[model samples]
Target: MKPQLLFSLLLASSLPAADAPVQIGSRRELFADSFLIESFSGTHLQLQTPRDEGVAFKFDQPWEGLFSGYATLVTLGDGRLRAYYRGKAVANKDGSEEELTCVAESADGRTWTKPELGIYEVIGTRKNNVVLMKAHTATHNFSPFRDQRPGVPEGERFKAFGGTMEGGGLTAWKSPDGLRWEKLAPEPVITKAMVPYKYMFDSQNVPFWSAAEGKYVAYYRVFEGGIRRIVRSESSDFRTWSAPVLMEYRHPSMQAPIEHLYTNQTHPYFRAPHLYVSIAARFMPGRRVLTDEQAAAIKVNPNYFKDTSDAIFMTTRPVEGTAHSGVYDRTFLEGFIRGGIGAQNWVSRTNYPALNVVPTGPHEMSVFVNQDYAQPTAHMRRYSLRTDGFASLHCSYAGGHAITKPVVFAGRELSLNFSTSAAGGVKVGFEDVDGKPVPGFGLEDCVMQIGNELDRKVAWKSGTDVSKLAGKPLRLRISMKDADVFSFQFMP
Candidate 1:
C-alpha cells in the first residue's frame, strides 16, 4: 500500500464513531433545518416565506383600533376560531384601564365577527365583546391558549400568561371555556425575584402546554446587555416553573447573528408537535426609513415611526433526555417576512406575528401578522402556505441530490409533501449504513415523482409499502430536478 493510504487509515482509526441512527417513528420531518440531513451534492435546503394573502381579520371595531395589536388565534375544541387581541385606542401606560382583551369569533377563519360576550363593562356598558378588563395589567397583553395536556382538569382547560415587569412578573389565568377567565393565582407565578433579569414581561410573554416536551413551556422577553432576547422555562404542571434560562442560538453552517427579538412567538406547529416554530418580530431600533413628512401623510403616529420592525421565522427542537437545550436553529439569516411596499408599513412594533399557525384547508396553513401599525387602518393580515411548507429542499433545473443520515422509522409507506414542474421530478433510493444500495429500493427502481401534493407516497418498482424496512437502519437519497420537498413522514 502507498504511504499516503497508510496515513489516511491511521487518521480514520483515531476519529470518533458516527452518530447513532435517529429514531423518528411517524413524525413529519420538515426541511426547516439541517438536523436530519447528512450531506448534499447538488441540492440545497432553501427556506420558504409565507404568501401574503391580504387581510384575514380587521381590528376596526370601536373597542379595537390604532394601538390594537399582540393578536393570538386559537382553534377551539368545537372547530370554531377564537381570536384574542389587546383593545386600546389611545397610547397609554401599561395596564391602563383602557386596555382590554377582546375576542372575535369565526366559524371559518375567512370572516371574523366580535361575539357579544357581555362579560365586562370596560368602556361603559356591559354589552361590549370584552373578555377581560379592569384586572390590573393582566389584560394589557393577555395571551391565552386551550390547554391540551392529558388529564388536565376541565375547569382549567384554558390557560394564559400576562403581566408587566411592574405589574409583578408573569401572572396566570384559567378558564373553563375560552371567554370567561379568572386568576389562577392572586400573585404572579414567575416573578422578577425568581430571575436575574430586571427588565421583562413588557412584551407578550407566551406560556403554553407543550405536548412535545411533556411539560409546560414559557418563552418570554428579556433585555440583556441592552439588547432584547428570549429566555425559556419549563413546568410539569402549569403552576410551578423551572428557573428561566437564556436560549442559545445555532446554525447549520454559519454563525447566528444576535438581533433584537421583540416577541418570540414560539409554539409547536399544529401538525408536527415536536418542532416549535417561532415567528419572532425583529426590532430594528433607530433604523428609521419613513421621514417625518411621509409619516404624517400616512397618519402614522409620530413617535412610532422613529424605528421599524418586521417578522422573522425560527425553529427549536427539544434535546432528548435533557428536556431543554434552549438552542434555537437559525436556518436562514434573511428575514422570513419583509416590510410591505409603503411608508406606513415601517414603524416600531409593527409586523409582529400572532402565536399559532393554524390550518385553514386540507393542504393549507395560515399565519397572521399585525400590519398598518400605529395608524387608523391597523389590522391583522393573513399569510398562507402549503402545509409544512416553512422551508423546502429545492433543486434548480440542473438537478441535485441530498442524502439523509441513518434513520430508523416506523410505518408502511413513505409519504412526501412536494412540488415539481411538469418536466421536473424527484427520485428516492435507500442505502444501507455501509453505503450500499438496497436491492429493490435503489434509485433505479423508483418511478419519477412529479406534480404538487401535500402527501404523495414514494413508489418503487415493488410498490410504496415500506413496512419491511421498519425498525432497521437505512439512509435515504433523494434526487430532484427543479423540485421542492417540504416535508416527509412514514405513514401507517
Candidate 2:
C-alpha cells in the first residue's frame, strides 16, 4: 500500500476525539514519529546516531588513500577517544606491497589526526608520509586497551589484540602511547580451539569493562558451512581467554569474508550489559520507495570489494545469567523484514527476548505492544499511558510490534490509560515482574472503559505506592483483551 494512503487509513480508524491529544503506547506508534526503515544499501553505520548526533565519521581521507577498513572506538584513561582502524593501501613503488594496522587518535570523536610515529620503516614512500607498524601485520580490526599496572609506571601505554589470516590465528600488539606499537607474543592468543581443519578465523575485541561480570567479552565472527555466525569469549588479563560460546545473533546478512562482526561500547542505555554490532548487508538502493513486500525482500549480503557503504547495525543484550538472549535494537532490520526480501522468516525464528528491566513508578513510563494481523491488510497498532488520568489510543495496523523508550514520570503516583477496537474488546491491567497481576488489581475481569469511537481513547488510574520502588528497579506489564497494541508511555 502507498505510504500516505496506509497512514491515512490507520489514522482514520483512530479514536475520533476532536479536542483530545493522541497518546502513544504501542511499539508501532512509539517509533512512528521519527522511525526510518533503513535498508542494507545505506552508507551510514549502526549506533552512529542517538549516541552522537547522526554524523557518520569519515574514515576515508583522499590524502590517506582509499579502502580504510573497519574501525573500533575505545576511551582512554584520561577520557580521550582513540580509534584503531584497518589501513589497506598500496605500499611499494612496484605496486606489489600493501600496508596494514594503521592507528589514529581524536580528542573529540569527529576530527582525526594520523601522526607519523615511525612504527614501520618504509623504503620509498614520500607522498602522504605513511609510516606503517614495524611489526608486519595486515588487518587491524580490534579495540585498543590501556595496560595500567601499579608497578608498570603508566605514561600513555596501551595494547590491541585482533585476528589475522596472514599469521594463522589471532595476534596481540603493544603501544607506548597508541601511536607506536610492538608485537607482544610471537603466536596468536587463541586459535583453532575446536574447529575442524582451518575453516575461517577473525576476531573483534570489545572495549567496555564489565565490573558486574568481572570478565571482558570479545565478540568474533566465524564462517561455517557457508553461513556466518557470531561467537564470544571472555578474558580477565587480555592474555588468556575462555572457550568461544556461540551467540544467538546469526543471519545470512552478517556474513563476511574479510571482516568479523563488531559491536559498540557498553553503556547504561542497555539496562544490562549490552553490545552493539556493525553488520554488512545489501539493502534497497537509493531513496526510492517500495511496497511492503518489495521492501521486505531486499537482501543485504556482504560485499568485500565495495567500500564501507553496506554495513548495518544490530545489538545483543545478554539476558544476564540466562541461556536465551535478546536483540535489543533492531530498527535497522525493519525495512528488510517488512519488504519480504532476504531472510524473510529469519528474525521471527531467531528473535528471542532479552532480560528487559521494566521501569516502575513513583514515576511513570511507557509500555509498547506489537501485534501482527494477517487478515485485511498487514499493519501495526499502538496505545499510550500516563501517570495523570491521561491516556489514549495511538494507532493500529496489521504487521508490526511495539517498543517503548523508557520515560520517567515526576510524581509519586502514576495513572495508566488504554483503548482498543470494540471487535477486539481490549483487556487492560498491570502485572508484576513474575508475569502475575499486581495485588488487588483484577486484570482478567477489569473491562477497559471505552472513551470514544473514532480514536478509541480510554483511561484508568492506578495509584502505585512508590515508597518501596523509589530507588529499586522494577518492570510494568500492560495487557489488552485481544487487540494488538504498540506501546504505552508514562508521564508525570
Best by TM-score: 1
The TM-scores of all predictions, comma-separated, are 0.95, 0.49
Clashes of each: 0, 56
lDDT of 2 by residue, 1-492 (tens): 432234335445553343332222221122211121122111122221111122223334332333343444445666555555544443332111353555555564344566565445544443332333433442444445565433433432576666545445666666677665556677777666533324445434443334435555555555544444455566776567666654443333453232222222222222222323233332222323333453244321122111111223344543333322322244344221122223321221111111111122332321111111111111111111222211122333231222222221233333333334664444334344344554444355344543322223323344344333332222333333333333233332
Each prediction's Cα lDDT score? 0.87, 0.36
List where candidate 1 sits over 4 angstroms from the true fold. 1-18
Steric clash count of candidate 2: 56
Provide the lowest-lDDT 10-residue window in model 1. 2-11
Total clashes in model 1, counting residue pairs 3 or more apart in sequence or in different chains: 0
Model 2 scores a C-alpha lDDT of 0.36
Task: Please give the distance, in angstroms, between residue 371's alpha carbon in candidate 1 and its true position after superposition.
Answer: 1.0
Tell me, by lDDT, which candidate is best.
Answer: 1
